[model samples]
Target: WYRQAPGGSLQWVSFISTDSSVKKSEPAMEGRALVSRDNSRSESSLSLRALGPRDSARYFCA
Candidate 1:
């Protein structure tokens, strides 16, 4: 997962690992944070905290 800042710079964010060996999620970008995670179903879900003024940016997941 990544977030594009106002200057169009892509910042690395939390990473969802499919590998069962890996435990917790990776760290998120500075000033940003992860809010929720739901992996009960086949498809995993991630929710970020409320967006602040600087939080405004285009997000992408791969």
Candidate 2:
């Protein structure tokens, strides 16, 4: 997943493998975001905690 703020470049947020393993996450999101995958559903999701005004941004997954 990646996040791009208004007028800012895209930044890495988190990476999870097809097999449901978390590979990486940006230091800034270490405690603020949670990335996970559900193998049975073949799905992935990102959860953000304690959101603030500064958290507004575009999120992408590829």
Candidate 3:
């Protein structure tokens, strides 16, 4: 999610899953706004996909 602060700067926020998925043991994950900086640095830029039930979770903005 993104919001404009009183000073007019934008802020982003988000979440990420740490555990591996059933599809790939070392899967590539992507997200919006807030990023899970906790994850390890990798060689390539990961593209994020919109989450459906197939992804097992949905991102919500208030």
Candidate 4:
């Protein structure tokens, strides 16, 4: 897990389960987005890069 601190840096928060099936549904982001999300069903992978400032926040799985 990670959080966007007030200074705009990613800070580790906690350990997340490595189990791929544990992720929650993706949320809506106006500008920032996840790529290869469809591969999640096959347990491939999803990546997020170049996230917008507004996309900064806490993230968790399950």
Best by lDDT: 2
CA error at residue 61 for candidate 2, angstroms: 0.8
- Stretches of candidate 2 above 4 Å error? none
TM-score of each: 0.55, 0.80, 0.21, 0.28
lDDT of each: 0.57, 0.85, 0.33, 0.44
For residues 1-62, write the lDDT of model 4, one tens digit per residue: 44564667764433323553444323443133332224456443334557676655765422
Residue-level lDDT of model 1, residues 1-62, one tens digit each, is 66788777887665656743433434544334542335566554446665667667876765
Q: Using TM-score, give the best candidate's number.
A: 2
lDDT of 3 by residue, 1-62 (tens): 23344445543333334532211212234232223322356321223456444333332332
44: Cα error in model 3, Å = 28
Query: Which scores higher on lDDT, 2 or 4?
Result: 2
User: How would the candidate models be sorted by TM-score, starting from the highest?
Assistant: 2, 1, 4, 3
Judging by lDDT, tell me the better candidate of 2 and 3: 2
